[model samples]
Target chain A: MIKTFTRNDLIRYIYQETTKEENTEIENALIFDEALCDELGDLQLTVNGLGRIERSPSKGSIDKILSYSKYYNMNAVN
Target chain B: MRKYSVSDSQLISLYKNGNEGAFADLVNRHKNKIFTTVYMIVKDQYLAEDLLQETYIKVVNTIKSGRYNEEGKFLPWVTRIAHNLAIDHFRKAKRYPTIVMEDGSNVFNTLEFSEDSIESQKIKEDTHALLRDLIKELPDSQREVLMMRHYMQMSFQEIAEATDVSINTALGRMRYALINLRKKMDKLNIAYDKNLYQK
Candidate 1:
């Protein structure tokens, strides 16, 4: 059986927070552990899928946001 | 025409200096994230839009009044505003979703968008719709963690701080969420990775 790493350890690995030597350990663990490796892959996919969602702000919306600035300043001076 | 590095601090500085357009530029740049962030909190698109607007308005108001201080990070500043407004809305309404159970098991999981054939984009739309349904099956905590981490681009540390959980706890939730999502995909025969799973 593959050695079980703590969830915190996995998270540390996910965020590149792992030290160089520890990073190698995680990689080696995955190579030896099927379930753990699959779990890591799943997390990778969820993050990738979410990252794929790009922001497409509507046109003219920025104008509205800017207008608020004008209104704020106007109110402040009054 | 000088691009000031596009950092939040630069944008906030520009906006505070009475550059109205700068405020708009910043909002436009981050509006989607703002919208998504608010949407995940409220789970209502229309209301989320309203709160999203309120967040920007408050930012404008704060900056114009010179009440906006240079903080740890400008992006987090606006996000904090958005987060507060969302929490306030929920408190006043006293309404939370049913699916978001105590244990954080709710449906708001996978969000995928597949491509169609060489014809029209109809199939792609269908894929998006299907993905939306799948996400609704995710537990509230999982969905929230997944969306905040993925969509809002918040780190686990940020999520922990924002959601009032320890980093380890947040990580555990996410890990379980992914495992649950994998099971859901399997049940539906969604074939998230047909090639890899086949072997």
Candidate 2:
């Protein structure tokens, strides 16, 4: 039986969020569904697009964290 | 001199046994994701930094109190703390409004970009900065899913459990996040490499 996939299903497939059985099911469904294939392609592009957006905490933040840990260490030892 | 290649679980155990330096190592290791996760949710750099410190303090307390026992999963465990603290801040501030705007404006103008000589470099950097801006404009729930899935590297099931939502709900949020990003990209006339998926 052919299965109808939702956008959520496409997301799970694109991100590898599905289980093995679900993956097999989605892969099997993708073979005959041109539209699903296209949607997957588009969503994959969006997913890859997200890689461009990167963020890191400030160095001051890291120092603050380490300083806090240092205080905790002093207290725990005493 | 402790080796720098220690695993999180091992470092955690060392901290539990009173080696506080190990705790610092653990915090340093996961600092980027934890801070980014908190910052994305709180949307204030200063407040996120405060919460980031508080989150580690709480983790230290939790481990000292003999509460943390799950081994080899330190990243997810700490992320759960970070997410909870961010949510608690949102609740206390009463600022988590479910406002979804159809038009992407105002928020996109805040990010500063540097000038690049190479055209490809310019496009790459601009696309990155633009996507970061658009992400801040996503609805609160969608943004959370995107951060957890893409940044924190949580599975759908793990995200659902951490956020206390259903797997289908988590999946739906991620789908909408991508779709919304695509729409914004088109609306803003930002041209990403069409063959991005192929590479």
Candidate 3:
């Protein structure tokens, strides 16, 4: 019997939050369900897009953080 | 020696033992994720930088004082600190409502895409910038869930606990966040094709 999954299940599946049994079942369902596959594809694309949008902090900010760490260390030693 | 082969827990241990280089490595390894998480919340690069620095200072203090007990979870712990600091900044300044500027321009517009001269690279960067703006447009609950799950790498259950909601509700918010993002992307005619973003 093919078990139907909800959008929430798909979300969990894509995030790898689903259990091992659920993973096998979802993989099986994806092979037979075009709509489910499409939904997963769209969700996966959106997640991937989110992953690509990282911004780095300024070098000066990082330097300040590092210096602060050293300063704290020096103070601790004193 | 391969840089970054050192795990976060290992780095934390080394830093606790007075190795400043280990601490620097830890900072460098997770700085982008922490910065982006704070940036998404505060929506200002400068504020994000300040929060990032503050977050690290807190990390140093916590680790140095031996109060940092979240072993093997450095990124998420620092991210939580950055997230809280950003939220606190808005709360203290009463600037929550001003997240969307009056002039309708975002701080991301000022960022220079100087490294990539290629047209495709530029298009990818532009798309990413636009997506960031759309993320800002999302409802606060949805955006919060997205930030926690995507940027902070928190599991849905953790997000639920952090936000004081059920796990299902957290998952639902994430689903709506992605669906709404897709709708906005379609409305703006941004292509979802992976090939288009390839260099």
Measured against the native two-chain assembly using Cα atoms, what DockQ does each of the candidate structures obtain, in the order listed? 0.34, 0.40, 0.56
B91-143 in candidate 2: lDDT tens per residue? Answer: 98787834333233223222233333456544555566567678889997998
Clashing residue pairs in all predictions, respectively, total 9, 0, 0
- The order of the candidates by TM-score, greatest first, is 3, 2, 1
Q: State the lDDT of candidate 3 residue by residue for B50-84, as single tens digits.
A: 88888887888888898989544677788988888
As for DockQ, the candidate ahead, 1 or 2, is: 2
lDDT of each: 0.62, 0.73, 0.82
Candidate structures ordered by DockQ, highest first: 3, 2, 1
Give the Å error, residue B19, model 2.
5.3
| Candidate 2, CAPRI quality class derived from DockQ | acceptable
Off by over 4 Å in 2: A1-4, A76-78, B1-7, B17-25, B93-125, B152-154, B158-165, B194-199
* Model 2: how far residue B124 lies from native, Å: 4.3
Proportion of true inter-chain contacts also present in candidate 2: 0.54
**All candidates: TM-score:** 0.72, 0.73, 0.88
Best-to-worst order by lDDT is 3, 2, 1
Best by TM-score: 3
Writing each residue's lDDT as its tens digit, candidate 2 over A1-78 gives 878888788887777767898888888989999989988988888887665454456667667766766676465632
Per-residue error (Å), model 3, residue B17: 1.3
DockQ of 3: 0.56
Write the number of the candidate with greater DockQ, choosing between 1 and 3. Answer: 3
